[model samples]
Target: MSRLRPEAGILPPVSSPIAQQASFGERLRALRQARKMTLQQASKETGVAQSTLSKMENNQLSPTFNLMQKLALGLGIDMPQLFAPVHEARISGRRSVTKKQQGREHLTATYEHELLATELDSKRMVPFKSRVRARHLDEFGGWVRHEGEELLLVLEGDVLVYTEEYEPLPLSEGDSTYFDSTMGHAVVSVSKDDALVLWVCVAQ
Candidate 1:
């Protein structure tokens, strides 16, 4: 199991169905090789360091959502394609049940993402149960804007949502907000400890 840096915290051991079958690094490597591209080429195109790309391919690093999105764009594919294992066809009417502590994990500087519903490909939305880590806006290097819409439902503690067009908004447990993903936004924990949220974003 790969992990992020110390400040970002360690990723939970994955118990998700997807992780049991394949790894993010393995899939990423396969995609890279399939296009006859080298790590240097990918790094140049994606603006990600070659060492980081190598670590990701070697399963020594866990990529952030933004990093994964950049890799997808560099590979000339959509984000969903990165999660899909080659030669595995999409199963229609797919149903999945992810128990607590049982989803594929990806740790980032700001949040820990547990990706859910990986069994189905060509999905319109991707859901994650995330743990907010960063306590201040300065912790995030910049705004995060992506294609689609996103909904965040706070499950624990307090969180502050910062948007490009609006002032910082505070949310408590059981509060939820839906916003355009294209808008620059970031969420930070305001609680004394950690905060949890169920985030669902539509596919680009």
Candidate 2:
């Protein structure tokens, strides 16, 4: 599939304060306090703006996918740890399989994700199935950049991927893309049909 260029400076939509005040905010604040680090100090370490950190801690703002990845690095934890409701000590030889309706599913602004292998702890990778919702870079708010690498496979319909360094790439069902997550990126459904994708990210 050919790639297309998009207009610059797209960002994600903001979440309501009430919705932002969920367990994620509490947990993020708790993690910072536990380290006795002020938001300013943490921001320096994480490369996130101090004001943004404050908003996140106070549940006044919600993070983007790349921001979450940055927070995970700042907290010295994997991305899945940020998503986990409770921590579980890593156990060896753990195995799990989930049916179509069995995995833990949640909706963010950009996608509906079903987390895979939640039973395991300290995993080297996080795997999930996501339904793409946004149809353009404008809907994404902005390009997304994080750490590590990611693999995205189109499961249902055609998808268009945008990155900072590359033109938008279009993929039909069964096509896949693998790249460094640190490069700013976003995905949209370009076809009239719905889009489902399998996304996997390695732990940093």
Q: Pick the candidate with the highest TM-score.
A: 2
The C-alpha lDDT values of all candidates are 0.76, 0.72
Off by over 4 Å in 2: 1-22, 86-88, 98-108
| Candidate 2 local lDDT, 52-130, one digit each (tens) | 8877776556566667767878877666555455455556677878788566555556776677876565668888898
lDDT of 1 by residue, 1-204 (tens): 122221312233447544565577788899999999899998998878899888777766766666766787788765656766533556666676778887766667688777786555556677889999989887875677766788999999999998887888899999999998877788999999989999988746
Give the best candidate by lDDT: 1
* Per-candidate TM-score against the hidden true structure: 0.75, 0.77
Over the full model, what C-alpha lDDT does candidate 2 score relative to the true structure?
0.72
Instruction: Give me the displacement of residue 110 in model 1, in angstroms.
Output: 2.0
